[model samples]
Target: MIWEKLKEWMGGGEDGNGEFQPEWITLLEKNLPLYKRLPDEMRQHLHERIARFVESVRFEGCNGLDVTDDMILTVAAQACLLVIHRDGVPYPGLRTVYLYPSTFSSIHKSVDAMGVVTEGRVHRLGESWETGTIILSWDSVEQGARDIRDGSNVTFHEFAHQLDHEDGPTDGAPGLASRAAYRSWARVFSESYADFQELTERGRKTVMDAYGATSPAEFFAVATETFFEKPRQLSGKQPELYEELVGYYGLDPREWLP
Candidate 1:
C-alpha cells in the first residue's frame, strides 16, 4: 500500500485491529513531550483517544501547507488530553480543525450589550467557534509542543473552549454531572477568577496569565494551559482553581509534573 493510503487506513481505523499505525505512534512519541511522560496506563488511553479524535475531526490545511500525519497526530494528541480521565465524548460538537501555516487574520462580527453591531478583522494564533470549527496556527502548535513546561498549547487551549461551551456560551462553565457539581464549580471558579483579576489589577505577578481576566471562558482555557503545563505552580499558587481543574479533567497534573 502507498504511504498516504497506509496512513489513512491506520489513522482512520484498523479493520480488525484497533491500534494506531507504527509510524504514527513513532511520530507522536518523538514530537510530543507531554505524551512521552504520561504513565504507561495513561499513554495507552491517550493513544486510543488520539486515534479516535484523528479519525473524527476533519483536518484541513487552510493555506499552502500540506497537512501531514505528524501534524494531525500532534494536534489530536493535545486535544484528547482534556478528556484523558473522564468518560465522555472528546468533542461532541467539534467536526473540523483548520490549520494555518502561521498566524492568520479573520473577520469577526460582534453584537455589544447595547445591541450595537460591529465587525472587525482580528489576527489570532488560534480561534474556536460554537459551530464546531477551529482555526489554529501551525507555528503556535509546534512551539507549544516543543515546550512542555509552558502553559500555552494552542491546540489544548482551543479544544478547552469546546469543553467550556458544552454547558452554554455566556460563561465558561462546562457540563457537569449534577446540580451540586455546577454549584461547586461556580463557587470555586468565580472566586478564583475574581482573585485573578484582583491580582492582575494590583500588578501582582500571578502564575495565571492576565488574559484569563478577560472572561470566564478565557479563564477556563488559560487555566487549562496552566493546569497541563504548569501544574506544580498552579497547584501551589491557586489551590482551589487547581482542584477544580483536577476534578473536571479527572486527572491531576501535579502527578505528571517533573
Candidate 2:
C-alpha cells in the first residue's frame, strides 16, 4: 500500500503535471528503432507526446535490471504510437507503468458466492487495465524487441490492451473514429476471430499464436502484434481483418517493413 502511494507520487498522481526534459528527447532519438521508421510529421508529433508520457510515468528497476533511458523511451514510443495514428484522443486513464527484471508473481483476490476471499497466483510478463496501470518485465520487453517474430511481444500486448481500454473494457474493440468504421470493425473482427477460434479448436495449423483464440480481446491484441511484426503474412492470410486494422490504425506497417 505504501509502495503504491510512493509510486503514485513519483508518477505525478492523478493529474500528471511532470516536466518534459530535453535530455529525454535526445535519449529517445539515440535508442528507439521505431522512431527512425516514423515520417517527419509523425516523428515530430510522437516526440512531443512521448516526452510528456515518459515524464508522467514512473519506472523502477527491479531484480537487478537496469532501467535505462533507452528502455523507457522504447516502451513509451511503442505505446504512444497507437495514439499518434489517431488524433485528438488522449491516453485515457493510464498513469504509471511498473517495470520488473523478469516475469513477476502477484496474488489476486477473488470472492466467491459466500464472500470468502481466495488468493490466486498470477505470473505474467506484462499486464494493463482500464484503471490506468501497466506492468512489464524488462527481460521480456528486450526479447520482444530483439525479435519481433514468434508472435509474442509483452510491450505491444500490454499497450494494445491499454488502447482497448481507452473507451471502456477491452472487448476487442478499441473505439473507432466513426460509427461506420465501428460497424465495419465489428463485422470483420468478429468473422476473423470466430474463424481463428474454430481452427485452433480443431488443432489446425495457424499462422498467428494460438493464445489469440482465448478471447476476442486476445485476438485483437495478438493481431496488433502481428500487424506490426509480420505485416505481410497477416495481410496475405487475413486480408479483410488486415484492411480493417490498416484503416483503424491509419498507418500501413507493411510499407515500413522489407
Candidate 3:
C-alpha cells in the first residue's frame, strides 16, 4: 500500500494505478529529446518500462543531493530504453542505483604483465559493479539525456556493463539466445574490437569513441551508446556491428529517428 501511495503521489493521480503522468511526459520531452523521437507504440512501452524500473530499483542520493521525482523519472526512462523491446524483467542483477551530484572519485586496481598490481584513485562519471550496485553522476546523466546524439551516455554505458555482467562476468558478451547467436556475437565483436583498437591507435576517425579501445567490456558499452544515440552514423560506418546490435536489442533505432 505504501508503494501504491508513492505511485499515486508521483503520478499526481489519486487512483494509484501507476499510470504515466502528463507532467512526466513533459519532463521527458524537455529533458530527453530522444524520448520524443520514439515511435508512439515504443513510447508507450517505455512508459511501462520506466514505471517498472522505478518501482524495482532502489535509488539513493549520495552526498547532500536530494533525489527528486524529476531526477528519478529522467534516469529511469533513459535506463529503460536499453530493454524497452526485450521481454521479462530489466536488469535482473541490478538492485541499487546510487546517484551523485557530479563526477565522483573511485579507486581502481590494475595488473601488469609482471603480475604487479597497482591501485589508483580516478574520477568517474558512472560505475557498474558486479555486486548489483551502480553509481552515477547526475550532472553527467542529465547532460547525456539532453544531448541524445553524441553517443556518450553515462546511464547507457553503466547499464550496458550491467547487461554484460548478467551472463557471468563483465566480458564483452552478454547472454545470447542460442549457440549460433553466441558464435556470431563473439566473431563480430572480437574482429570489430581489434579493428576499432587499431583505428584508434592510428588516430583515424571512428563512429565508435576512442575510449572503446580500452577493453572488450568497455567496447561493448561504448557500442551500445553509439547504437542508440548515433544509429545512422554507426550503421553507415559499421554495418555488421549495427546489424548485430539491432538483432540483439530487437529494435531498429533508425526507425525511431527521422
Indicate the residue-level lDDT of 237 in model 2.
89
Candidate lDDT scores, in order, read 0.83, 0.77, 0.88
* TM-score (all chains, Cα) for each model: 0.90, 0.80, 0.93
Q: How does model 2 fare in lDDT?
A: 0.77
TM-score of 1: 0.90
Query: What is candidate 3's lDDT per residue for 156-222, written digit by digit as tens?
Result: 9999999899989888899899999999999999999999999999999998899999999999999
- Cα error, residue 203 of model 3, in Å, equals 1.2
In model 2, the Cα lDDT at residue 80 comes to 77
The whole-model C-alpha lDDT of candidate 1 against the native structure comes to 0.83
Off by over 4 Å in 2: 1-32, 62-66, 87-90, 108-119
As a TM-score, model 2 comes out at 0.80
Q: Model 2 misses residue 227 by how many Å?
A: 0.4
Which residues of candidate 1, in runs, are more than 4 Å off?
A: 1-19, 86-89, 109-116
Candidate 3 structure lDDT? 0.88
Q: Which candidate ranks first by lDDT, i.e. highest?
A: 3
Q: Across residues 124-168, which tens digit of lDDT does each residue of candidate 2 receive?
A: 888886788898998788778656556577788898888898777
